[model samples]
Target chain A: MKTVYKKPECIGNKKPNSYCPGCMHSIVVRLVAEVLEELNVVNSSVMFAGVGCDGNGAFGYLDIDTVISPHGRALAVASAYKRCNPENVVFTYQGDGDLIAIGCAETMHAANRGENVTVIFVNNAQYGMTGGQMAPTTLAGMKTTTTPYGRDPKADGAPMHVCEILDTLDNPTFLARGTCTDPKNIIQTKKYIKQAFQNQLEGKGFSLGEIVSACPSNWGLSPLKSIDFINEKMLPEYPLGIVRDR
Target chain B: MEKVFMKGCEAVAEAAMRAGCRYYAGYPITPQNQVPEYISRKMPKLGGVFMQGESEVASINMIYGAAVGGTRSMITSSSCGLSLMSETIGWLISAELPVVIANFQRGGPGIGDIGPTQQDYFQATKAHSNGGGRMLVMSPGSLQEAIDAVFEAFEKANKYRTPVYIQLDGISGGMMESVMMPDAISDEEVAALKQKAKEEWAVGKMEGRERREIVGGADSGLPLQTLNQKLEAKYLEMEKNEVKYENYLMEDAEYVITAYGIGSRFARAAVNILREEGYKVGMIRPINIYPFPFEAYDAIDYSKVKGILSTEMSIPAQFIHDVQIAVKGRAPVYNYSTSGGVILDAVEIANHAREMMK
Candidate 1:
């Protein structure tokens, strides 16, 4: 008789999931929930879900107060969530498309306004849930499904640098970039998440982290290859480092 | 009773105190900034708290958060700020969170000047704001009414467990006037009201947190997750029972005017002039716009009244539509609207009403 590795009990095990193999969403959920459980704030925490595979399933998985918003409006919902319930631990997890595209107004305003909330922006370069559409962070000459002609450098602007953009905002207290493609990076990414969350909990205003993650299904590569892609390619464009630490 | 010669803003703070509101969160904005300044100085002395939030959008959300925690709370802003707050206002309405939002409206398509205007009637009464929804709209004419309306807005808000607006502006908010403060609501009264408010409007905070029947040893730790079903049923009841209006001189008039707040005050003066000029005119002032006073029309002397006039400061007019529906072709609804900081004066209002008489 042998026992295989078990998923964290904190994650809601609701049958089969829609995410691709080696997706980091389950781990991320477990990590955050563990932090919340450790803080004894699982019941009091309210998270706004973005418009992605990771975003939509939050309400079902978290067993806590949750709100789902239109693509890119996570910051706006989180702003309201934090505003109305300042005592509660409120945060948002947005995708690259969700943060940089339709939600840009909300994101900029939420940051510039210095709202007391944390934004965990998952930048996978391409839209993952919608099957590899070009996102704001899509690399120059990157071949997303929408950019099949290999993302013409002229037509597609360079992969957006969001952490730097947010860092420039005077109001935000902390801004960092991290990845979860490997074990070493995972520890650092978790540290960034904790700091971002602490910024809100301390009532120090907005904090964000631009997470450089891999999308194997969308990247036209195997899970391990995409993980390598993040370490090798995405890091150069995004450059994993603290843009603003306060 | 405190006798204070105060601006509309000061009166609101005093009224908020009298009504049992102990928490205030807002930012500084023209025509309404006085509210935050007033609270900042007053709240601490009264054993309450106030936060000058970062923006109008953030300010309203803070109101949402504090109210959910069972603190009597409010947020105040003008038009530009209110537009920023529209998204969260919808959520508060959806969540049926009891909060008082004071709208000291200003002119705007954008940066449209920070004078006075009643341009929010449509935005308030449209039954939809952020992607289309509803809010309880209340307008106050006099400085006294501004105070009273806020107090009533809180009571009504907590009663129905919904957000209520005390819509004021340059005409109603900026003017200097003397108001004898209404008797301060006793501590016992506020406590009793708060208890009733919790029972009526508050959804418990956590699972097994509903103390509806539990006797003692309340779990102070977990707030209940007041669920989807219970809120839906509560919302339906609110929609049915939460409308208030003030009807004047409709008993023997030949033409009645539909109005509210400053407009209603102007219409009252207009009716007096109309009566002297040998034409009978009366005015209907709706206290609550969403649960509109459809019943007021039921009680109106429709035989005497032939038409109605709807006056507001916003151009792509909003309240006139409600007037049309409430009258239902029994009397044609006429529109008298202007934008860009135009406050309809007594003479202008009288003329508008007199023209409809002819």
Candidate 2:
């Protein structure tokens, strides 16, 4: 019998990932691995893993050269890495808090400068590695550990739309948002990721794919329920599809 | 090798370029701004990268990235700007990337002032970052010395696989001096250095080698302890091999003065004045502020030496703590410091030494 699918060769099997059950990080990691392998650029690629649960398992799972950047500075690191090694493909995998909050300046400026790199922004609406702290992407009325009484629009402000923010920047070559809630969405998200990487390989400047991911452990919902929550809550605030494709 | 008159910041930038520093990322800050300005104009012409990061924080992280890419990278800033870079500096240390950082310090407990001060002594030498790690801090007193230190810093950083810091005050950064300019490393030589890094450890294509992972952030319990121990061993090795200092007129001296950076200039002047007045005074200037030349203090004759004076531009005397530690209570260590950008006076320092003798 011919095998239809197997793990991507770029993913190492030495250690099991530490992501929680039903965490979208595992799928996203596989998608990225598959993309890198498909492009045949796995050997020439360097991944900058931002500080979050999304990046915690990157080194263990991905069989590629990886640099775990200090929290929220992945874009800045990736920008310089790309500039220094222009022949190599550089990309960043970061969480909402790591990309949109503490590292806002780096993210914005890297985009503005049209750094030739890709950014895989995993927006799970809360800080997963540090438990359920409210992130910049956390929707108003959504509850997190920091927003225990639910995020009030007055106090917490509205959810941040990162793709929309980057849409205003003239330098960005690609900006797309997709989710990993279902098989259909996962495929679409992978397409966006592939495009982002392709853009980098083509020397197109500053491509980013905002992946609306799920964190069941932090959202206090069963893995199955978190999928439903994404459809009901997150998509309305963030929306899905390309905000810019220059 | 003709001596050329150049401003301190420009000279240091030229020195770094000559030292094979191919990547520079920094922000605009007083005194040190000239460093980035000079590089921005010259780096691209020589096939190097110069980035004006959005903030000091981003600039240092960019240096971290370039270092990871196996390029000679550097960042320069002043006191307040360096404060913004402390977190990334800790990350760079933990990751064990060899990068150079220069701080042209100004007065600061806050925004403070844009004038020369050595107030960052503790910050640079002791607690450079939150996590327990140390940089090989070099304190250069003049334009020539600063250029020399920049060259040595890159060599030492690559040798040890750790960050090397060049500590300069505003006086050293702003003043002009005649210095011999070093020849730039040829393109072939720079390429060879990068090739060696690719073979050993840099993050890049893993064609035939095992994939490299550069880990940063806190490890816990035994892992954290082990990491700390490893760092300590590296630091100890540096202490053994890299300690540098200058002992001026130390032989047969009854009184000794200790200073670093611009303060040493003042101390030297005071030493000359005191020697003319028949009061035997010498100076011990710490060139490597972290390894700190404790042996120099040990070599002092406390029996005949009445006192040791620590002179600097910080208000409450930060550098004195290291001086005392080096002296180990052999003699009373007194401080003659001027704060908030006030330059130390040779006359006042001489008077203080004379009073100690009396």
Candidate 3:
């Protein structure tokens, strides 16, 4: 058999991943690195890692230059970086809690202004880094530490569909929702990640790929069960597909 | 260039632009609104960015981002706005990013008024942030010094790889005075400076160099103690080299009045009044509030001094604490203050100093 599927050189191969097993953060980070390498922008790319398990993953895992933004402020930072250094490609890697909860205004404003940057938003339905408290994206009936009795739609509010929200914004050049569970879906997610980055590289303003991810340890399930949870429960609510493209 | 009459807020903003600041982000607030307004009109013409952030919180973070990207970035705000930015300021200090901020202070514990007050001295010098982060806090007393301070703030910020704060009261911010502008720094100069700094320290591709990991606070991968020790050592160095003050007319004086910024201006007037009346009085005006002119206090000739008087535009006199500590009981310290946006009365301070002499 011909040797194929070698790791991207942009990956920090010597270090062990700090993410829990079944977490999609490592997979998403690798895909981003691979896309940057493919586009020949790995050297020019800068990643703003927002505070979360995924945020911490960037420093040791991604060989590219990385800045860990204060929780929920990655987009604001990425916006500044892109405006200041227009030649460099900028992107933000953020989780559900970081992007939506404390950082809601930053997310909305960056998208509204059509800043030239990519946002790889990991929606894991809970605050994975801070030990799985309830998040803005936590499912309507899911049981989180804060929502131990299951999220009540009346008391709490519905799960936010990030792609749908960004679709309403006129300036965003591309918006897609993807999930990584089965092999086929993983490939599809990588494609969306590539396109979002291509948007930034092409000077297409404001692109975001919302990856419906899994937090196995936080969800109190085995790695396999988490995959099933994403497929059965998350797919119906989030509905993986492109919500906007121009 | 001939001196031009300019508002203190606008002068500081123009000075920052001349000093090669390419990015400015701020929100509209009292006593410092001219800063953002001036930048909004000027930055586009300068081929720079001026973003009115959603709030002071967002503005400081935007500066953080710009600073991390190795641009000369700054933010301007008043007391309440600065209070909102304190968290990001601490993070900037911890991350060791170079950024400049101007706090054109208004009267406040909360929304006091849109006028000059020295109420934020303690907040600026003592409790800037939660993690024991120290900023190079420079307080400018004149429009010329305000412009000069803005220029020097960037140099000090980039030199130390830390945030440098230019603390001006509303008087220095809102008052109009003639200022001689510095030579404009060319766009090419700014770009070259940013490129050089980026190559040396910014978060970017390693190329052939070792990977750079930018961190702040206790999270820079070093043990907590080691990181703190490093920060402490840096602060000690700042204290030694960065102590700045103006010893105004202290020679052969029987009484010394201590103040900073607008308060200093008033105190100087008070000193002049007492001197004309044949009472020996002088003023010690601290230009840098952080490594505050403690040595300037020690340099005072105690044999001729009757008592040290602290004059300020704050209710309970915040700057007096530092004066008392610096004097170390060699002379009693008296406080005369006018607060809540009420400008300090020079004659009242003069009378107080005369009484102390008696």
Candidate 4:
């Protein structure tokens, strides 16, 4: 009788997502699309997609002007876009490796310069696109394809806390960490993302929402077990909360 | 237009600004640092953006972002810095984004000294980036030519939806010369240009149009093949329509000297000295290094031409490869080169030509 719920108007080109079962990328993409539509900035937003599974994931489904940036360069690209088209909402959807490891300088500098843009950071704890290798966010003593025995602090170092790292900078207007392991966390994560986009619209400086995601195929666990792994193991290292909101 | 004495780097920056370049992101590299310094001071006054990126990698990607937004954007770097930007250059090529790049080239191989060298002739004209990407590379020999090339570069970049490179050297970048300054593009004209780009291909506020997607780097298999073929067609078109060269004292000559950039100045001087000595030497300088002025070489008369000498400020002669390809063994091609910041002397170049005649 009444039209209560439907797909996010921004998520056009109806095609099946290519993310693995239990992977959090699809949920995050939908949340972002819904936020863009809710803010009525879908036509004015440009998505700078990072290199990784997120590249294919975001570019494939998001019915918006998207630019698939070179590996580890999305933030730099987004910063330029925002500077040029200050009226348009610009954001980068990047993974742990793309944002934290290879692009550490760009990430830190973009945050420091306080570029008016949003960053959607997906932390899956391992390199998912390139066969589950060790990433900068890989937990200490976590076994991965490269670190089969376990990530050694001496060899691999501890996991990087992006929100904490960015917290030290005074330029960022919002910095929060949330997960998509369950409905409650998913809603919270969407709020963080929506706030990041709001910061851009308000001409507030750089905002980043780190979504602690799960990798079922890479973690060598079932989809259900991977959710448990994120809650029990990953949550302690990368605690969920707002690290900065200035 | 009043002629004013200006350094090469400053001239380039001013030329870009006049050509409607509203956004610039560059790192401070020797011989080209003046470009960013000048832009940083003047860009704000013009209501344009100028950012000194953390690295060349970030700066080029920033240009990528600005270009995608339909803004006129540019970046400048030297040898090692240009090498740092090669990755994103490849991405820009694949994405077919329009951006201007200037390489005030220095000695290379690895962190070579910050002095003039044509060592990057191959890097600029042959392999700007990986994946067989080609840019319309222009070699500007003088300050006036440098300004002209920057204006031409932006026009061609937007027309073809591809990156355009200005291949300069430290000598051209550091030298001071009197040049006529062109009138700046009004803010209204710049806005109209950007609007045209957005309506055509750039990404921003789709506004009742189909959403635009600019994808690069990860293409594989058949899609990559299709992209390569499309780019090849564009490059071929550029070759056909954009080939530019200067034939100096070439008619009724027995020996022809070939060069580009600052090396062309040296060759021109050598040609003058040879003509005074009654050796009948001339010069052919390529303006667009990628399209490469092969037709000029093909037009040379083998019957009267004794030899074609290719001279550049690089070891093992990088620019000569193209010269040889152009000559196609129609005449003897001799290469005389200097490397690692050494400037070629006109007398020595003339002596080399004289020896070829003997």
Candidate 5:
């Protein structure tokens, strides 16, 4: 007997994505597409894209209704979209820099309100499109274009653990952190993404899935080495697990 | 129906309910704060959604999202809060989304005071958002007009698929008066309205059809010039059909007083007093400020008119430039202004008109 592995119908045939080589955005997007197809929600799902490199190419890779919002405004827009059309599934694709830095207020408020929406946050530890500036999720000692020598705790403050912070909020129905470091981690990430959508579909308000991703070009490392970096350096700071579930 | 005595802010909120608005997002700011308060308590009872956004910026973006989803939505703010909202207002214009915004203006240039002032004349009529955007700016002088503008604002906003503004000052926002509120539409009617909008233009459920993409940037594949030309055509249509104003005693007059909103009330009163004194004085009250009643001035017998007085509540007079252009040098333009939320009295305005005539 012969078997066939097929791409989900939700994934547009516009590949390969425009993201740089070894970037994890395409992988995460593919997993989301597959989950949407399995849940039979491809027809009513809408994706709100952010301004990062990954977000700029999201609409091209996903065949669904999409709206690209200003930097740090995707959550607010997605919240409104979900409130207006409760039957349609809405989510936002945001980077760490967009969600944890400039959009902290929106991220907190939307979750506090328990809006029936999902947020897919990709934390690459730096601003990838704008040349790897130090982001809120950048590790304590990590070096980026903005950090120069290194991220100084005295001057730049410690990196924020968004999952831990959001776990304190009582309104979020689901909050989890996963990674794309290896095939095993990727599968785990996909599981979390599916569960987040399931929570929203079940009318469980405010689900968030954070994916710890790698940036090879910005980290000045090869694609394979970047995965090792995430395993050694980023994993300890951001432990992968379900931070909140109620 | 008997007239309902209500505050201007509450009347505006009730008017929005009558217009079938199902979503409201706003932040609390003085003068206009009552608007959001009323909506917050009432919308949920009507099976509508209401959100108190963290900031004015977030509130405007929320409305942008709801509007794109083909829902009747509105937001209210005061002068300073409106300044914070200018960015998203531009986004709404760029995307050609229909949304209603009501501003109960307070004194400003930088938190000047909490008093009523018409200092936002240039901000509203000349430039609201970037890229030369224009909105149908309707200034209401009375509580009755304030209620009526809110109902008509949603109509015109959806009609043109563009943003419309209801400009009021803090005085009217805080005052109480009898207003005939429009009856609410039936629940079935509201549902049908939403259904028609979604099927025609909303970004909802693209099943069995090409997916929809609404962008607020030049990425729509249309060149900047092309997009601007389309907007210009719409503005011209508005100018042709929507310009509104009142001509009082202009049949045989030597001096014409041009004013709007509260200033019009004072100007009209001054004109009546001057007329009783056997002086040829009249008033031209502009209801729509954007497509300013420039053409209305054409009816004036310029050969007999000596001057035009532009009255407002701002220090350095605004709206005079439009008056000058309308007069075309046929009659000299003068101004009478009182700033810092100081409303000029009818007696004082009458004296000023007397001086201008001299």
Candidate 6:
């Protein structure tokens, strides 16, 4: 199989990301970068970087009017900036842990409020930043540093289906969850991100795209096996698709 | 000026419209929501935009957006909604955006009750958001004051490029009374004012590329001497442009009472009682609290006034600090306050004043 080298302009100069070797974080990061460059929004749009590993999101790899927020706090900050300065396109790049865990309240409220902001939710089943801790999106039987015996719904709470919860909101005008695990999903995920940014530019409110991710080291698998886990395990639990569209 | 019997909330809305405010965004909450309901219909009639946002947080934010777009804008909400908006208010203050927020205060440490109270005094003034920028807060006593305050608030916010607030309670907000309305400025005159707004907002300007000027200050930590100079000039201009106060019946009165907004209304009723009983008393209501009518304090006969009675709706209360600043102990200052649930009554204020006199 052949792979496309990272685009020169899309090269995230920050460093090779710490994501697992075969991790799609690198691919998604490049795609988002290319889209920003393509849309000519790279310099104009203010990127509100989220918490956890995605804390330095925005590829953290570029020069932009970036505002890095405390964990789960990025959306509120981004929405506020956008609300105050609508001419400046604002969006937040977050993760399952950042958007779902401590930040859930702000996440749900931003969607419910239909704030004219864009959110890129990176959902890897385990906490990649702080050891491979089980995340809110961890599948029922997913094993992790915290849930060694395989998650017991009786012992641990059920993973919150984020896109579904967001769809329940009347204000979240666009909701799409895509994966970058393969060639096809990678193409689809880029399309979702481009649309999200376009909606924000057009003053459309509350658009979000969740990118389901993988963890090789934490899942006790090689880079190749981690892709299989996301495909076989994470896919069945958190399916990829558009949940809401206006 | 034509007179109309109006609730405090409605008067606030009318005041904004009269001030040439063309944009308003808010979500419905009790008490202050009436301001939005009235203006939303009235503004479009006059070719303004009234949008109901999805939530209080969003509504306030939308106001921020509109303000940045160089339009006169406002947002209104009660306690819970205001809390939700506190973070945005910080951003507004930081960005130095010009806008107005009408906080029709309600009870609570959290959703305590939507009933009337002066509980948000601390939040209104101090919560100007931990960024350390002083936001001017105006409290009005009568329907006229509410209307006038709303108009004045926009002007002050624009001049200073900071958020201004009209702080009142349910009693102050819901009460119905008559007010002398300002004559409408012709749409052409407004268009002229809108045209001049370019002087402040670059995009609104008629000529010149978007220029970022730098001023200098000695202690400004800003090495750009010119940038500091510009900032100092702006602050000096604001000092002259801002700060308003009202002094009523203070002359020859031994005990002068000081209050604002609903608290002033309570103070007025009490003052009437004392006046009818032949006690020498008067009231001073602060129309603007940031520039803080420093002149009002300078002009008063500190010796003639035996004491100053401070009344408000919060637990720690307010304006007493102003008393210290204005009077500086030339006269005694006494305070009366009720927390969260109720507006302090006329009788209570009168009693507090009578006791202070004794």
| Candidate with the greatest DockQ versus the true structure | 4
Compared to the true structure, candidate 5 yields what TM-score? 0.96
The lDDT values for all models are: 0.72, 0.90, 0.87, 0.91, 0.87, 0.72
For model 5, what is the alpha-carbon lDDT of residue B320? Answer: 83
Candidate 3 docking quality: incorrect, acceptable, medium or high: medium
Alpha-carbon DockQ of candidate 4: 0.78
Clash pairs for candidate 2: none
Every model's DockQ, to 2 decimals? 0.12, 0.76, 0.65, 0.78, 0.68, 0.10
List candidate 1 segments past 4 Å from native.
A1-6, A13-18, A37-54, A65-91, A97-119, A127-136, A144-176, A191-210, A241-246, B17-29, B40-71, B108-115, B182-236, B314-317, B332-338, B352-358
TM-score of chain A of each: 0.92, 0.98, 0.98, 0.98, 0.97, 0.92
Q: Which portions of model 3 miss their true places by more than 4 Å?
A: B218-221
Error of 1 at B168 (Å): 2.5
Off by over 4 Å in 2: B218-222
> What lDDT score is found at residue B212 in candidate 3?
59
Fnat values, one per model, are: 0.06, 0.89, 0.56, 0.91, 0.63, 0.02
lDDT of 5 by residue, B171-235 (tens): 88898998888888788988887888778777878878767667676543467788888889999
Candidate 2, residues B234-339, lDDT tens digits: the string is 9999999988999999998898989988899999999999999888889999998988889999999888888999999998789999898889998998888998
Model 5: per-residue lDDT, tens digit, A1-246? Answer: 765877777666644567888999989998999988999998898888888875776756687777877677778888988987999999988999888798888889888888889899999999999999999999888899989889998899898998888878889899999998888998999999999999999999999999999899899999899999999999899999999888
- Candidate 4 residues lying further than 4 Å off, grouped into runs, are A1-4, A12-14, B217-222
Better of 2 and 6 by TM-score: 2
Docking class of 5: medium
Ranking by DockQ: 4, 2, 5, 3, 1, 6
Q: Taking the tens digit of each residue's C-alpha lDDT, what string does model 1 give over A1-246?
A: 776755544457443344677776655666677666666766566667677765754545655555555456667556654554566787787888888876777788788889888887888888888889998898888898899987776777777788888777889888888888877887788888888887778889888877887788778789888888877888988887788877
Could you tell me every candidate's TM-score relative to the true structure?
0.79, 0.98, 0.98, 0.98, 0.96, 0.74
Please list, in the order the candidates appear, how each scores on TM-score for chain B only.
0.85, 0.97, 0.97, 0.98, 0.97, 0.83
Candidate whose lDDT is highest = 4
How many residue pairs collide in each prediction?
14, 0, 0, 0, 0, 13
